[model samples]
Target: MAQFYTAKQRVTTKQRITVTIEDLDPFGQGVARHQGKTIFVSGALPGEQAEITLTEDKRQFARAKVTRLLSSSPARVTPRCPHFNTCGGCQQQHVDVVLQQQSKAQALSRMLSKEAQRVVAVDEVIAGEPWGYRRRARLGLQWQNKSQQLRMGFRQEASNDLVDIQQCPILTPELEALITPLRQCLRELKAVKRLGHVELVQADNGPLMVLRHLDALHVDDREKLERFSHKHQLMMFLDDGSENLTALSNNQPFYQSHKLKLTFSPQDFIQVNDAVNQQMVARAIDWLDLQPDDRVLDLFCGMGNFTLPIGKVVQNAVGVEGVAALVRQAAYNADLNSLKNVSFFQHNLEEDVSRQPWAAQGFNKVLLDPARAGAAGVMTHVVKLAPQRVVYVSCNPTTLARDSQTLLLAGYQLERVAMLDMFPHTRHLESMVLFKKT
Candidate 1:
């Protein structure tokens, strides 16, 4: 008879185990094997030996927290963030930055090769400043009853407890400078208890701070926020459970890429890293080898981030998005930029959209920038369009690999691929790949 063990029973049985780290998982955790079972250990790097305590035990694999570093890897470095050990915002800060990029690129290449069943050569690793590149961040807020103060910062690693950090190195200097003043302003608000989350964005025009609250702010609270905005020379907005955003200041928040303007709402999705995004958009345009007469399709296009820029060079560009609001904004951006060749349509790409009018329009090139849930549903319809080239921009390697297999099966050959270091000191990997019809 086979024996089974509960998580507690297994931990009590093993207590602690020392093992050599073999490799790293996509999340940058050290991978090790013990007693014919896989163990994932945090804060341990490849080529290191560590003693770990089991935190979770499953039938297939177990999760552990490193207790002692028996042997340290050469590539390991002291993390710069003072709260690196506690803050959950970053993962690879302990590893050397160059080594982190190389490891990520290798992992991405391996995934693509395994999924597509062909040798995938990574062309280049697109990288920029590793720190202070993040232009947007959402911070958690909590009232400490004992101190009668508000705790503001990111959450703890793997826990919901907010880390009271005074400054974050990952955020742009303009946004980081407001951390202290923002906290002070929140403390003065009578509706501070109603505060849910704080979002800070460094738009191209200026900095914008958004305060989300579960309840409406009092008149005094709004005045306090306005003062803070004026003092910091930043725009302020309030979201009080209403679907619309109420501006406390007259400034509008927007960002520019490729000489094109893009206005976004406080809650709308935009790439957090500005420099990396510019390079990514340029690469996508170059890889498509777009021509004056070429018609292009951009799937999951958000607020014309890529659509308006690509529309400038192509004969006609069509962008499809799931959210109608974003589609409306994209169209507005096209008209704002005087790009008449671009058009946007609202359609849920997760379902069959082959019957949609835009789907029937022949496009010689297609660009995909889907969320972590890759573009599987839209790929079938895309195949029907038979675009000559397909460019895939992925945030999740696992999903990218899954969708790559689908594309390979549809007679598309994976030609060029690269990794973009969009989020440094983090496990998140942003990559781009080009597929050409054989």
Candidate 2:
């Protein structure tokens, strides 16, 4: 067990130390060691020297904030966003793009090494166009009574406090331009006080604003929204008791191009970066290499993003999701897309899949897109199924490493791994790996 620092001990002690930033943690924080204990410092880059103030010291590790950069790495760059420190949206904006990819790949490799007892090499990071990539976002609206101003943006790191942002360089230009107008709508609406949150979805067409209101909307507020939507030509949705939306009588959703045409709902979880996501999905399918007679299993499939496309080339595809609603939606997406070979089923994959009937079947290939908590329990089942090849798309490297160990233990060999720059200007990395049974 690790020792816990008492409140009295924490308040009395202040330690000042200079340490060389050794590496970056999975969360994009710089890591350093002093007296054989680890400390995490924000805004510090590897190969840089910095002064750190210990905020919380535990038996095994400590947390800290960088007070001064004694030396800076050449890879460091000025952050594009003014709210880089306060807003928790993008952490690695200050780091060079090439360095960010290296950090992420190293983080994944380290985690996998610890669990697998073997060196794992991560492929070069996939690059995407940096700006105007974010297509989906949920903007927080907070009316600061003292300032008497409405703030529209994300929350500060480690606090419920909202960071008032005038513009976000990380978001698409279309979405960033809406920040001021969104606040204007709030200012005009008397019932904006009842608004819980606002969702901004950028379909290929244009931006769609879904206002989630907790209380009833007054007639004047509704009229204000209608007028704003009409003048700006925006598609607006008001959430009453249900998520059912009534598009503003005057405006329609914008369409960008036929190639990128995609629809989104307020409640659905869409990838924030549109351009990179399209590439990421395409890469997954390409790596899977679906054949006409191939059977594919998409674990943790959400809304058939990958399943429907893979189904187009395979004999049949089954998408299993934890949420029943998502499974239904995925099935609906298959039907809507005229994909005949795709089907969806709800299954609690975190738990044992051996109990499920579908678990008994073997497939020629499998595609997994698990959450930050990677597919731990399902890896064993995957080994037993022993598909010729397995393609895994991961959001978190630590969990991916642990699961990689499970696969290795089950006699699967890691063939190749590559990082996808889905969320640029951030420490967040989306990666894919291919595995084959030994």
Candidate 3:
């Protein structure tokens, strides 16, 4: 008898609402309120009024897409790329480049402050070229049955449909120029149906392309790929989800930073933006205040990007990576650079690393460049090493905040924090924070 009545479900009407954007969320979505609930609107900016149609509605917040713009912000500008609105590659393209960096920096500072439960000041935003800076990209390939053509480009926002792009302004000139030619070559290839994805990298040597296929190519298809490689003067490789990289060209692919050349395979993970990467490395070294006789540890070291550079200045530097191949490559790179004092170890950082022999070594300084998951599990073991200084480079702020809380609780105080605009015009945020043991 007490539970006789049942509450009716609230119906969400798909109606357009006009609201003034008050702020920008971390993902560059405009924040507004409707019916006492928060709503995030895409393609809308702060201090602007727009008519938005709700795309999603939840108990706490809703998501919407801007259908009409009643007013515009002074910070708004025309996007440079023709596929800006359709392509999912870049967000915040309509906002001024400088404003984009500032917004990201502010967002990061607020996040860190909240996480640390104290006021945190953000240093000047480190930025580079806003366009044509992307040196690496994984392009999608789709066979369009309706047009009897193969579409090559990034996927549309929130859709699997590929945005057939002739050229992407964000890609380096060398890589951008290959788009049309690569498309044509793929269309002519007999192995077109087996194609999975195409990767383009503007290496220090030259443009290196990797064609991923589901199955092996025939002799004729291989000959065609060779011809394409020769015509474009590009180093090419073929990958079929195998560990080995089949070379299509003899030319080696490499990149340079901090006066060191790093040779890598097409499948290797390297920073896409070289300019920002160099700056970030230099700043990391400067902030660490490396001593000539000090020992340093570089965790999640990929092919010695930070490891080799730090090794050059330190008495002893040890690089640790989860991948065995990367660990071997790190050692090779160290040797290539004539860095005799560097060493590398292969271990899974997410697991218990305290038992590792290298973990017992004392380190005065530590540098962590972890992926989005952050170095939470590794931090526990790292604390045992008791490094005097720790510098964390993070691509995702949420994880950084979580890890920073752990570091703070472990008697580390944040010294300096800065944002690196590694990927401009996108919601991705890269930040570096220095922590000193209290």
Best by TM-score: 3
lDDT of each prediction vs. the true structure?
0.90, 0.79, 0.90
C-alpha positional error of residue 84 in candidate 2 after TM-score superposition, expressed in Å: 1.5
Candidate 1 regions exceeding 4 Å error are 1-14
Residue-level lDDT for 243 in candidate 1: 84
The worst-scoring run of ten residues by lDDT in candidate 2 lies at 254-263
Query: What count of clashes does model 2 give?
Result: 4
The lDDT of model 3 is: 0.90
Cα lDDT of model 3 by residue, 1-438, tens digit: 476877999997788999999988667788899889999999899999999999988999999999999999998999998999789999888988877887788899999999889989897688789889999999988887788889899998889989989889889999999999899999998878768889999998899888998887989999999999999999989998988989977887888888888988787899999989999999999999998999999999988899999988989999999989888888888888899999999988999887788887889899999999999889887788889999999999999999998889999999999999999888999999999999
Name model 2 segments beyond 4 Å from true.
Answer: 1-13, 241-243, 249-262, 351-357
Taking all chains together, each candidate's TM-score versus the true structure is 0.94, 0.90, 0.95
